[model samples]
Target: MTTQGENIAERIKAQAVSLGFAACGIARADAAPRTADRLAQWLSEGCHGDMIWMEERAGQRGAPQALWPEVRSVIMLGMSYAPSRDPLALERACDIGRISSYAQGQDYHDVVKKGLKALARWLVEEAGGELKVFVDTAPVMEKPLAEAAGLGWQGKHSNLVSRDHGSWLFLGAIYTTLELQTDRQGQDRCGSCDACQRACPTNAFPAPYRVDARRCISYLTIEHKGIIPEEFRAAIGNRIYGCDDCLAVCPWNKFASSAAVNKAFLARAELVAPKLADILDLDDAAFRTVFAGSPIKRIGRNRMVRNAAIAAGNSGNGAYREQLERLASDDSDVVRDSALWALQRLSDG
Candidate 1:
């Protein structure tokens, strides 16, 4: 016979599914294993790079309960954003810019947080519990909590990978004061696969299950707020917003379903293999207008143009020389520098 708490958990999960979550599981708020020491070690190694916020919030990020003492249960939810086609398909097409699949559509933080709020409200009505919803913005260690909730295990790429959803999940968490039955933890299914590591264009991973964020294309493009280091510019290729090479190369993705349950995750027609020349044309107004609801807008016009300049340089197409030359005197120093480099690369070729 199921206990009352188990029955309530089942009902809450069912409600989450109805609210469009791909999967939902409960975990004890304090279930994170080695939560503090591991984070301390990663920060100590300086793997987090320019993302100083991670270091600042290291104490609270170490565990969920530490952030919110009253939280008895954490409801972890997964929403799938699986692409309709191969993520690696556009990698070789130099003229077109490649966006990581997650940023190719509407911003997931908005979409996932909306669903999280709805679920939290429903929980309040059904169980009368104090709840706080969080997406990626919080100090919570969502990946570990998701693993503890049986949603998925952190893969070799240091991302949550589900047997059902692969690595295509956007995670959301709801911390509740109500006691809830916890699910069994997901086991590490990655026995021996280095495909994700081998596929990294810059070898961002120094060892298994570890990533040097300083060398990661995603961090360099989106998070690092300065001129991207020239050493990794060539390897950055056409990826503008983020790089999906590690996630795309996971063998476990073979089990991933093609269709996305959330329409918000589906790629916008313009973002799918956008031309470098076109992206180079986006001014501040045009950039904001084009990516108003997309995650790409967060990087701002200068960074986007900077990334486009790098892509244009790697294109090996002399046709974009004029565009590169025009941007050589751009207002932003990073853009001007990147554009000058692109012009030189093209000139040398």
Candidate 2:
């Protein structure tokens, strides 16, 4: 015989699936000890780089009750955005830009938030109780909570790796006063597989369990505010925003998220292997128009062009020489500096 709570949990899971989320489960709000310790050490080492928020809210992160004391239960959820195309093959082509799987469509934050809010509304209307839903926007330790809820286990990359969906799922959480039935906690299945670490182009993982963001290509290219170091320029390939090498290299991805987002994420005509020369020609208006909904829009034109300048230098295609020279004179100091660096590299070759 099922209790009222069990029925609610099952209905919630059913509605969550109906809403397009790939998986859902519930866990009692609790301290994520392992996640907490790692985050503490990472902050202690100052590895988060320019993201000061990671330090500012260190106390709230991974601490369920710290964010909201009444959080008796945590509902973990995932929405899959795995695109069916080859992100790797697209990188080498050098004509199309590669966007991370999550950035391809409408921001997952908006999509998931709407769904979570609806679920929370439903929970209140039917199940009755106070509840709060958070997409990745919160300090809540979503991955660990997802693990605790039996949705998945954290891979060596420390991202949640789901058995059914692979690592291609985006996670969100609902902190509630409801004492829901709990799912079994997941166990680490990464066992002896260092594929995620070995695949990093920047060697971001200082150790199997830790990622030093300073050494990560995604950090340098997207998150880091200043000039990219010369040593890593060539290795960055044509990846204009975020590198997928680590996530894509994970062997488990082959089994689970073996799909891709539709044409929205499919390398846009201009983005895929676009010539560095073509990108350098864009003015500010063009930049906004081109990547309107894309995450690349966040970096603005200066930084992106600066990155393009690096690609131009690495291009070795003498045809782009004039284009590189034009960017070498870009109004922004950052852009000119990168253009100059690429010009020198190209000239030397």
Candidate 3:
């Protein structure tokens, strides 16, 4: 005979699937107790780079119960955004700027949060318990929670890897007051595989299960606001938005089918392999118009152009020199500096 908690859990999972979530699992509020200490160590070592938000929310992020004392169970959900094409196909196309698969579609924050809210409402209607939903924006450690909930294990690249979805999952959390039966936790399956570590263009991984975001191309191109350091520019290649080297090379991804991808994450034609020359000329208004509903809009015009300039520099294509010269005089210091670097690189070549 199934217990009341198991029945409720099955219904919740069914509801999550109907709401377009590809994976659903549950865990107690106190699961993954070691996450707090691990997070503290990562912060202390400064692996997070300039993302001070990680440091500020350390206390709440490491533990779910600390964020909400009344929460008895955590529902972890994943939405698939598996790419239909090869994410690394543009590596040799020097004139084209590569955007990460995730950002090639609509902003996931909007898409995922909408689903989370709908699920939260359904849970309230069914169980009559207080609850909260969160996507990536929150301090919640969704990956570890997802692992504790048996969604997947954290691979050596420090990303959640699913046996069913591979590395192409967007995690969300729903904290509820209703007691629910926890699922079996995921076990680390990355026995001897080091493909993800070997594929990093910037050697961002300091060790297994750890990432130094300071050297991460995704962080430099998307998160870090100032002028990118001279060191990682060459390794960044033509990747303007985010890097997919580590994620793309994961052997586990063979099991991830493009058919599992949510429609909301379908890649836009313009973002798939944008021309560096076109991206270099985007003004503020044009940038907003181009990336209106996309995650790339959050980086703003200056950063986008700056990233484009870096890609241009790495391209060794003299065709970008005229645009580089124009951008060298840009108002933003970072954009101007990157454009100058690109111009110099072109001239040197």
Candidate 3 lDDT tens digits, 127-149: 78899999998889999999999
Model 1, poorest ten-residue lDDT window?
A: 252-261
Best by TM-score: 3
Model 2 C-alpha lDDT versus the unseen true structure: 0.78
Return the TM-score for each candidate structure. Answer: 0.98, 0.92, 0.98
Sort all candidates by lDDT, best to worst.
3, 1, 2
lDDT of each: 0.90, 0.78, 0.92
lDDT (Cα, 0-100) at 34 in candidate 3: 94
Q: What TM-score does model 1 achieve against the real structure?
A: 0.98
Off by over 4 Å in 3: none
Please report how far candidate 1 places residue 186 from its true position, in Å.
Answer: 0.7
Query: Which one wins on lDDT?
Result: 3
- lDDT at position 55, candidate 2: 81
Regions of candidate 2 where Cα sits further than 4 Å from its true position: 257-275
In angstroms, give how far residue 171 of model 1 lies from its true place. Answer: 0.2
